[model samples]
Target: MEISVRTPAVEPRAMWSHSCTLDDLVTPYAVDPTVVARLEAGPGWARRWTAVWRASRARVVCPVPDLADFPTLASAPVRSFTWQARQRHRPGLQFVLATSRMHGFESLEERRLLLALDFTGGIEEVLSQPFKLRFTAIGGGEDHTPDFLVLLNGTAVLIDVRPGHRVKDKDLVKFAAAERAAASAGWRYLVVTGWRRHVAAGLDALSARRRPMADRLGLHDELLEMVAERPRRFGDLVEATSLPAVARAHAVHLL
Candidate 1:
């Protein structure tokens, strides 16, 4: 049997372009063939991706199985951590405007992913170490914890952060289980192995406008009106605006 993976419906955009959505910015890493083969080894492995791997059948603690009940489910992170010296991975807290709180990250990659998420708008909340997933695999019962749970535009997204080459067979199994768990909750799941081409560079450039700036002159509308007619190169776009020097900052702010 041939098993196919679900790919996110996101489009790649240029660095200066404001055409992409939050979903577009957070690109999913390419699937690995070895990992796919390992996940597809078992007889019923393909079917298991849609199964519920919750805490239990009686009590649903992870989140709501329906989108309507999602709002009523209030939650804090299921796990906590303490910083220690000589650790292999860097752990720190970053203040995200979307949540209006400091969210935790286990590694630099995770931190970067958080920044990318925050850079895009419409992120309602971000919780680190959201819940403990109990899954039944061919091997047996295994528990796994996801990195982050992001509520974007009334939709929940479960995210796991691991480098592309660092993903092992066990990791694939856990991610599959997480996907199943997310599916049960009417949510989307993403395994962020790495960024897409030019995304890292694009994000870094866009970071300059991440924070708010005073636009007393209302250059945002002017720039929007100018760009609406046609796409312009970054340099030319700013120059064509009413106040060339002032429009430069607003141009990036619009992005």
Candidate 2:
């Protein structure tokens, strides 16, 4: 069965000529194959050589609650019209907008629809798609559904979302295995922990204090403080941190 899922739409307004530069237009998202396919399928579509200033812009139409509701935008205004006339009236073509003015995107395949959702709607579901890849530990195995897993810069990785926890060694092993697989597979992994400060203060007594620890770099003051006092348990982080939104990544490093 062929799946023709609508691609994530771009907010072209953020790419104004005077405001945007050559580099912004060259990134992976800007020239994504899936994105380009959708654009080329539009009327008057041209792959211009004049660069970004003259390249055709993608539509930025009225906002509805979701991609399924975007068709409601066609009846608005002509100036507001994106492919305003006929394409919107096509026999069978779907247009979806899963855009944000403040962030970047990292899709998995050249042409595909990925997991997307709004708050309170994201639930843990099995990898129903056969193409969805996951790592298996040498023997440890995966957990009560991972906290989160989705694509980024074309890689699939795990995310942690529990607010706080009394972590178990078994959970740690599963996470460690996931990390190792991600590295070998060239995917990114992340473990976002919260409440570092409180945990740190609590661990200070157990730590071998070095007057001023060098582990204070890059982390939030709270987390840095915790690490400064002593080593931390992975569970401490689970208790403190919240999982990142499906569309927004919390961590960037390889697992």
Candidate 3:
């Protein structure tokens, strides 16, 4: 049997230009120097803390979309990845956005990042390759397309994902243009490169805990209570439970 789902509708906005300074992109959130100083005392803390701070503070300059715009934005056409297979058949993955459409990702990296985004407790909605934002560049008018448009904490964020090695001078210019556009719209902008290993792994493990059997057997509540008392290994948690061997294995898998 075939199932059909309706794509949400979005209203089109007029294109406009906005300009921003380098400093505007430098710090998206206000920073406390004292906290930074304390964190800097630890080995490798400065670098790690700096990255976290930048990501957290990344400011949006775009206007928050009203509730009505969600359906339209969620229904936006995903960028085609058909050309990608011409070079090599890298397996693609699709995400079921909060809006309920299957949004495709061209690379495993993008998929992993999407998982991370979905696991982010604060994210309200996600729209992939949502819309084009036009901006003025050095010599002419240019159009910039961000990879994802995210709504969190009642604000909008424009995200572009690129690996560090592939970032070029021209790409920086494009990002600058995108940043300005985001600022004008009262939204924040982010250029995501790497994922935090622990965060990604934890979310992946947590996502696996959604099996119906876990709930039916009361293993879900038991496991949560055990973990809350103190961190426990998967094997230990399984052993602690009175489930049969096969059931124990399944429970561990869920954990």
lDDT of each: 0.69, 0.28, 0.51
lDDT per residue (tens digit) for residues 1-255 in model 1? 233434456645454444555456554654455543433345554334322222322223433234225332355555666788888989889878777788999898888888888666678888788667655666766778899888877677888998766777688778876776676677888888776667788777777687878888989988888778997788999988779999987887777
What tens digits encode model 3's per-residue C-alpha lDDT throughout 1-255? Answer: 221222224322332112322112221222223322321233432122110001122422222222223343325433445554366434455654444456666566566667666434466767666655444444544555677777777677777776555555556656665555455456777876544324456556755653345346666566667768997766787778767465464654554
Count of clashes, each model = 0, 7, 16
Model 3 CA deviation exceeding 4 Å by range: 1-75, 83-85, 88-93, 198-204, 208-211, 214-216, 228-236, 244-255
Give the clashing residue pairs of candidate 1, or none.
none
Those runs of model 2 whose alpha carbons end farther than 4 Å from true positions after fitting are 1-144, 195-255
Number of clashing pairs, model 1? 0
TM-scores, all models, native as reference: 0.72, 0.24, 0.59
How far in Å is the alpha carbon of 93 misplaced in model 2? 27
Which is the leading candidate under lDDT? 1
Error of 3 at 176 (Å): 1.6
lDDT score for residue 171 of model 3: 61
Q: 2 or 3: which has the higher TM-score?
A: 3
